[model samples]
Target: MSNKATHASGASSDGAELRRRNVPGESNGSAVPTQAEVDNKKSHKPKSQSSILSTLDEYEFLIAPLIFTFLAFFTRMYKIGLSDIVTWDEAHFGKFGSHYIKREFYFDVHPPLGKMLVGLSGVLAGYNGSFEFKSGEKYPEELNYTFMRLFNSAFGAVCVPLAYYTARELNFRRPAVWLVTLMVLFENSYATISRFILLDSMLLCFTFTTVLCWARFHRLRHESFSVEWFTWLFLTGISIGCVCSVKWVGMFGTALVGFYTIEDLWNKFGDLKMPKVELASHVSARVVGLIIIPVLVYMFTFWVHFLVLENSGPGDAQMSSLFQANLRGTEVGKDSPLEIAYGSRATLKNMGYGGGLLHSHVQTYPEGSQQQQVTCYHHKDANNDWFFYPNRNKPLYNPEEPIEYVGDKDIIRLIHSQTGRNLHSHTVSAPVTKADYEVSSYGNTTVGDEKDHWTVEVVNDAASNDWTKIRTLTTSFRLKHTSLGCYLRAGNVNLPQWGFKQIEVTCVKENKPRDVYTHWNVESHWNERLPASDPGSYKSPFLRDFVHLNVAMMTSNNALVPDPDKQDDLASHFWQWPILNVGLRMCGWDDHIVKYFLLGNPIVYWGSTASLAGFFVLIGWYLVRWQRGYQELKPIEIDQIHYGGIYPVVGWFLHYLPFVAMARVTYVHHYYPALYFAILTMGFMLDWVTRPLARTHKTIEWAIYGVLYVVVISLFILFRAIVFGMEGDNKQWRHLRWFEKWRITD
Candidate 1:
């Protein structure tokens, strides 16, 4: 009975297989399809006439990026060489690039990677670094200015396609990607800044690439640990380092990535199905890829920076005495004594980062003590030289007296070598810092009072503190007024014009032991009794040099605040940038000279800002609906809400909001990075509003897109002259200026 039941089931299965295949089985058990099956398949296949269109549709991503990149290149490259003269920031950055070509070390508030690239461009173009690069001066006829400008423009042109790819990675629709690309390609300010040899274009390019790589990495979260996943994670890390190496503003992009990674890890931690080992692997991967990789890449850029710039230049004075001593062609510490003695004639440098040499001039202070002016001067001159002498109660400093090395807790008097006056302090209030006592040079070397006495207190010794003797450039000490008990300090405050606008020297009543402003070190010692120090002893460690340079950069950046005494017509407020309320003239305003304006295309700028506001409104509306128990969002919709809406919003905030607290002078170009994020938000909002219409009302969606494209294109064309460089009278651009605040013309 069992055998008969099995036979029946086998026969039924064979009948069902035959019916499904509609063909006969061969001896090898492979089905032989009938001619009709072949015919049916052929009928469904695409014809040769439509095959090309199908292939194009399949590779829309590649084709679209290529098209946008070509357009971006055209816009950025058009007439890039028209301005043969050094424009606004070109005067500064071009000189920096020359320093690199000459192998001369220089200082700047920004990082070195961008300027290094600029120098590379100049080197490739056979530039000799002969031109002074003065503002508004014409370039040398033999110089290859066009090639340098073209190199920088390449970075700006690539930004358009980077925005396109970033949008595609965010799952934006085709039209939205086009919108973002067009906005970046046609923006006037971006194009203008790229046409000159400046750092802004490189900064924008790296920033855009960073966001693109980050978006790609975020999408691979579900496939963690896969080859493609790890590839994107590493790329994102590299992009972060490159962006930061260009400018510190790149920190904003890094912060955006950090915020996302934290949220992602936190979410994964809550998943009950995930194994403990897997979670640990995820955390480890992020630490290696995001933290370690970026740090290494950032350090590599600085290493290259130090390697290429080996010779000392104008920036030598800005660095510590020990750091400068390591540079070739520097006179610092050459033929100078190692230890400072009572009769040593030396230049004292404030230990604070970005501080200057202790200086005094013959000019008397207009206020307070009306004594010879004592200030911190960045430049070196005879005025900076001072002679160390004994206190008034003790015998005067004698070169013959058994070489008495200046030691800790020793009473001394400092006399100006040129002015023949004693470094003096009094109870009068300081000129700038009212709470502090006044510091001035008073009394001659031959005649002085007790007010000139100062007690030396050693703060730190680079080698060892066992020896009480002070060493030049290695020991930091403080000068305490013997009578007033105030510490002699030189803060960042600038004195009035009467005092040569140098840093204010004052005596602080409170004793802050760690205050770097109060710390001083002998930089250039000239004592005949003491022997010269070993040159090898001045070698600065890389880590210490790196940290010290960064602190100096920060100090210099902070000193860029707007001056109350003068008005800067080119500077703009942070709020004015979003609204397009002002613009800057990039060169000479003469009627004959070519002029360029740093202003955005109004339609793109205004539209993107409005989209930012609309995003917040949409979020509020959704929260209200959800609170009332309406859960209408699908899985895809939720994903779009986060990646397209929340991500770019956070990026916009990170880049723009920090400027609100910045005390430095800002310009219109400062807003371009944040503008990139706003453009993304605009694209998302446009897709959000137009997507539903495409399914239900096709004609209305097409009409809306047509209007948008026309408006964006028309506005770009109207203000195109401003970017390409305008000439003739100011009235010629009157029609282009919609707002009075726009300085497109005089």
Candidate 2:
């Protein structure tokens, strides 16, 4: 046959085959179908079914996330209000919220945004801020704590969908994305911490948001400087600020973003095709979105904090004398004598950057002479009051006598006004700083001892270089122990619970004249014989006050160390966290009271840890295979490994490794952020392991995934009691304990 005849014969045979198969709209061997036949063929399907499948195909990306988010919220809000009593750190954060509602300025180590949100929740729920929020305290009927809990729960619940979208942004397959969402949604620890007025939920929420936004931004690098790129970058910055505002731990998340940006910019810098102007634009955009915006947002939170808290509260003493003066109810440097005089009653403040007032109480030390405890107290109280009496060399300080100005080289006896005892230091070892002598209050007003004597040596006068009389709130002075020649010091060494967690007072034998801890100044002075100084002279600028308060906050935060004398059952090491060696008791172990334990699901945590290990192993195996002239992964797979696998590992390291070097007390909750990255890594591993199986052995791949889903869901059910609240005897529920170190039942 000719070439044209051959082509026509093939087409006729194809049409005959189509008609025999009875394909839709192609019956009776018709080569062309009319519009009526086409419409009839489409109408053979049910209207609702066709419409539903079309809608599913159109919005398929949103279906899984929406379902996961609803389930997440349901789980988190299920029994959030079960406990009417305060649990764990609610004692601290809840009280902070109350302080905000009452407009009472209180000092805490953490930033104010988290507590501000808590206070906002309280305000919305109509809480009066009258409740003390003591640990394990029962909530009043009108407290509406449930609403506050629900508000916090909302943040944690949203984290599930954020994880899902973040996985999708990382190019995870649908099954892997579902796994990531399921891990976060069912994680017992995350859910448990979210059910209270604490900051962890907010912190986690912002952290997840930052990571998700960063992933989106990274994916849009191909569309650099596009509106979508800029939007994600800006959102990442805002999320960074918010996360950090909740707690300093958020800096770890910030560091993750920072590392990714630096690497990205460095890669772009090496590209020869990139013009200098484009590079500059990239640099400027990152600087604005990552650095400037976050800083502005952080500072704005503080501005709001300062604007709201105008009245003096318990935290007034933590601030500088001048800053305290600015508070409405504070009497700092107000109507107080400017110059120190004999028989003057005053509070001696340590002149260090974050020092406390010299205070003594009637409670005796457990060891070291067993005398009345003298410590550095950060709060104002009557115990801080002291009488500056003249030494034995001078006549007994009397109100009837003429006003005697206390000058340099004057020997004085500091009498604890509350205890009628002198500030005494002896050769006995200090409670914490054993190298120094113990400082204590000893001897009644009628008795006398040389140890009680201290030389008042003025270091310098703030108002004048040439001044004989000591000045209040300005003169930097030292109290040299007359007998031991040691200087009275408060070096931020915190004491045990017996000492009320106050800074330890010590008599340092090393006479370092430049030691700020040894420096002392009169904070609150009272002398009926002297005239009040000018209040206008004590005006502290806002910027100076702001810096001073932040430094003070950091100093106090660093001082939170474990007491060597006692065992902190609540404390855990960083290594113990990953292995699930311990769990925290969120409330009392009372039989009637509802209890919550902060613990991760064993299956989820263990699998995440394994996934982290598996990442390194797989990467090593691939490198070795490539070096041996065999390639296991293609270019696309390599890119996936770099962006999805390596990036999450970096994030995990950034969030986790810092804890190893930290001197502060750490707990399992500290590991939650790192746990999130680990979860991502786990999702990546899941996808990597099942990728080939999904293409070839589809049944086996689905079976493995099915097993995982079942195991994860089953474990969540088993661990639900820990998050939802367990009551009655813990011994009865001991079967839930999976590890020897897990003290969950107890």
Candidate 3:
């Protein structure tokens, strides 16, 4: 119970469980499990602590992770409260934290879990959330953000030990654990991120814990229902939820868990002791524990989020009128009764697959389908509003006599109220979408013709007509272009500034009803007859609010095309991450005289990169030898060393490779997850490579490792000023800026 895996049953308790599973010397009336097989199962129980201490290996258990954690925290804490200035993304997240402290509802592209922690940290430290965390704005002297940095630094400290335990769990030797701990402690980019009020460090920390927990579970799965097995599995799920709550990038951790689960089940299925029917139980448990539990936790976090931020803030314009009504301070409409009518002026959002507001603007796409641009705008605007008509020949609605309900499948024409152009489509190809018919606002005359007519279809036939009726609060509707022989779709492609950067509206080639975004609810309705006091009628439920938040975040993320004019020199290319070629510009540019950079320590970085490559070669050689029967892999050694190397490599790629394909801007810190993976990989490989050398000449391996730590420590000392904030003349910065891309200013 002394170590972290006490729940998994300690080495002392493992004797009984090990005998139960293996039945030593009592084979199933046949060949007994070889010594190798017993070692494979028993290795999960770490050697007794007293035994390790007697031999001096206790330093690895007691000192390595702790020393590294202290080292990392000590390094990170140097300038924690020294300066109070807004830098890079701190302005965005810090401001979000402020809004949270103020109990104001706002929107973010990411889930609120990270911001909640940030705000909570500030609250704990006596921050009142009063400062405007604007770009280039210095923090007021009154706000002490030290606790915020310290909050994340605490997570970073745990990560140092997390790397150690995770590597050791893989059956890696003590040297591997040391390397992983040191790698995490000495990484410069990590050091800097830990010092800031950022979510990346927290994300990294949680992700590491998630993987570590899963690793322990994997090592102890045979002992089902044991406290350790249950605890690790439960912790794995909890850590997964925590990481994802911080950022969607945490989904990658879930992906890794999913893969591990499959591998687990697959191996169990082949076991003679496991009946095929038992596979169902395995799957069912995972579905509940891994899938259901994490989902519930993730959703619950949002529940807390929506509860706290009840007041309205800047994001009100990005949501439906009904959803906005729930936010305190929002000017919501009052209760009023109205009926569906042809002349009713209502804003129609795309009720197809893409959930964009049915919109039209004065500008036209320059290329093919050059009609007045009809697009799906995410924002609520006058341009998104439309007026329904029954072709030009039909007389204007006789409002005095009666109001006609425009029920499902009713033929209608939608005229863009702002542009005075009909929502028209033809056989011509859409501007950006291939093979899809073009859809645009086109009506040269004041009225629309056959080309403009569209058949109206209600999205949910089962839902109450009372809710779907025109002028009703957030009624869902769809439009089918009568002339184009196709349905309307809110295309995901974004238009240029000429079209106000909204999503394009395309005539779909098929009439697929499954597209969720195409399902639109009228956000704002205008009918003088329907009195302006119907706010309660438009109250959006929690699910609808969740959907609106997602739609808004997706659109915001998509619209993030890089603006060259706004692009900073600090933006790093995807390749620069591994080689430590560039780093973030923490404080600079005619703002703060002190400059800080988050570059990796070059020796650890380049060494890890080389180690990763060498590891691949080592694996290839081992496989070739095994195939030729020239070598027999020691099963016990394989678990701790070669196979152990795989988890981190997978993690590294899971985090790193996806960025290579990402179109959005990337920077060096994005590589830290992969960097952590590489460190673990190096740890496993070095332990394996040097074990023989250490046996023949014990001092050589320790000497090499000692040399490595010395180099790392020396580099950290040299780069400390740049890693932390340091003010100096240009001459001093030139020496610190080792790479040309690292723009450390005076």
lDDT of 1 by residue, 206-244 (tens): 999999989877756666898878998999888889889
Question: Candidate 1 vs candidate 3: which has greater TM-score?
Answer: 1
Q: What is the C-alpha lDDT of each candidate?
A: 0.84, 0.84, 0.71
Candidate scoring better on TM-score of 2 and 3: 3
Q: Top model by TM-score, which number?
A: 1
304-393, model 3: which lDDT tens digit per residue?
A: 888888887776656665666677876433333334567667766554323566887787878776778888865667887787666655
Report each candidate's C-alpha RMSD, comma-separated, in the order given: 8.9, 9.2, 6.6
Off by over 4 Å in 1: 1-46, 463-466, 509-512, 529-537
**Rank ordering of all candidates by lDDT, starting from the highest:** 2, 1, 3
After best superposition, candidate 1 residue 99: deviation in angstroms? 0.7
Q: Write the per-residue lDDT of candidate 2 for residues 1-746, one digit (tens) a residue.
A: 43222222222222223112111122212334568975786699788876887677446567778999898888889888888998999999989999999988899999989999999999999998999999889999999999999998899999999998888777676677778888999998998988888999999999999999998787677778778789999999999999998999999999989999999899999999999999999999999999999988888888888888888898888776656666787777778988888889999888776789999998999987999999998878899999988777667777897888888888899999988999999999999999999999999765878888999888976567865888877778999999899999999888888999899999999989989789888888899889998542755566756776777889988877776877988899999988788889888888898888889987789999999999999988988989999976655467678888999999999999999998989888999999999999999998887776755676887788788888888988998889899978888779988776777775
Candidate 2: TM-score? 0.82
Q: What TM-score does structure 1 among the candidates reach?
A: 0.90
Supply the global lDDT for candidate 3: 0.71
Which residue runs of candidate 2 sit more than 4 Å off their true CA positions?
Answer: 1-54, 272-281, 360-374, 381-383, 388-471, 474-488, 495-502, 505-518, 533-537, 564-569, 589-591, 632-635, 697-699, 727-735, 739-746
